[model samples]
Target: MSDPAPVSTIVFDVNETLLDITTLEPLFERLFGDAAMLRAWFAELVLYSQAVTLSGKYTPFGELAGGILRMVGENNSVAITDADISELKSLIVSMPAYVDVKPALDRLRAAGFQLVTLTNSAPSPSPTPLEKAGIAGLFDRHFSVADVEKFKPHPDTYDMVAKAMGVEPSGLCMVACHVWDTIGAQSAGWQGALVTRPNNNALHAPNVPTPDFINSDLAALAGQIIDANTAAGKE
Candidate 1:
């Protein structure tokens, strides 16, 4: 029997996976008088992004994010000022990476994996969030859903990465903090590795495809990928 193909390309989801989103809490607290509104706004952003995609409509993720923030502010009876939106945008593009991200990415690269990113955020003329976070140079490529006009968990979003990399879906592994993202990548025939970041985890539903690797620590997840690839005779 032949060995199965090894996953040589690791595709990462940017926002919460690599960048520390908790840093935005202060902005949310200032805007809505509640730090918890950070999560609320993010959830709504994801929900509406997918909703519009499913409805055969398209809106740039950045614009949609700003819209969601305003919607949250209005719901809380707080006015979202232009300056507030500008600050939010600045903070987003300047969010720092989780401490574990760089080391794990370095380890994976050393293990001979091609590392790249797939983000729902649209392309920016300025330095990207990853670039601003000081890790963009480490990636071989960065993909945005803006090109596909769909938000993630949509199969097309995952498929676009495989197509762009010129590799079969089976040759890729998606490393993400979101279960929905892993499910989408897996459904597109890529292996899934879920980094169980705070407030993120594997959802074990009978109909859902559980991730192939799950760890709270990205370094541990990198080790697992390395070990598996080594065992499969990847050099």
Candidate 2:
């Protein structure tokens, strides 16, 4: 049997990739008045996501956010009301994108690449921070893993993206700052690109699958993708 064709669609991981979650730290600290507790809460939210997926229990990302915040409150000896939790959830929907996002996305689009965004966030009442960032229209499709009820490093979540985008796993490149996410995509038979941002220092697990490409920024990645596609006759 012949191998599948080279990649054609470029799917991005939203949170730490296109969007900058660091901007939300001040907001979280202001709301909780404990920076350390807020950081721990964010970390725990990731832990819970994996736990829930492994246990076959699914919760919306918004619900997980609230639950994590409440856990932070409990740990910090702070009392948080339901209303406060609701407001905090709303704030989460407004987190800003990274400064380089718009130009990078525009370059990719201009290069004739099909662009899509795949996020672990839930479908919210209002436009997500990506939409607010003025780059939402740049994406051919925006998908939330909420539909699949799974999180990153879960094959199901990556599969949901491939199915929705109407592309074979081999024809898609999953790009993210998170190594685990890229590893998951690679494991699921998709090409993967790891964006090596400075603050993102999580080590790839031993014996975990490595991504097809790793670059320090999207501009570099865009160039590499174009060169790769040209060499593969996909351009």
Q: In lDDT terms, which candidate is top?
A: 1
Candidate 2 lDDT (Cα, 0 to 1) = 0.78
Q: What are the per-residue Cα lDDT tens digits for candidate 1 across 156-233?
A: 998888999999999999999999999999889999999999889899878788888889999999998888878877
Clashing pairs in 1: none
Instruction: Mark the 10 consecutive residues where model 2 has the least summed lDDT.
Output: 1-10
Cα-based TM-score, every candidate: 0.95, 0.87
Q: Write the per-residue lDDT of candidate 2 for residues 88-200, one digit (tens) a residue.
A: 77667777777777777888888788999888887765465777877889999888888888888799888888887788888898889888788788889888787887555
Whole-model Cα lDDT of every candidate shown, in order: 0.90, 0.78
Top-scoring candidate (TM-score): 1
Q: Kindly report which residue stretches of model 2 are placed more than 4 angstroms away from their true locations once superposed.
A: 1-5, 31-38, 202-205
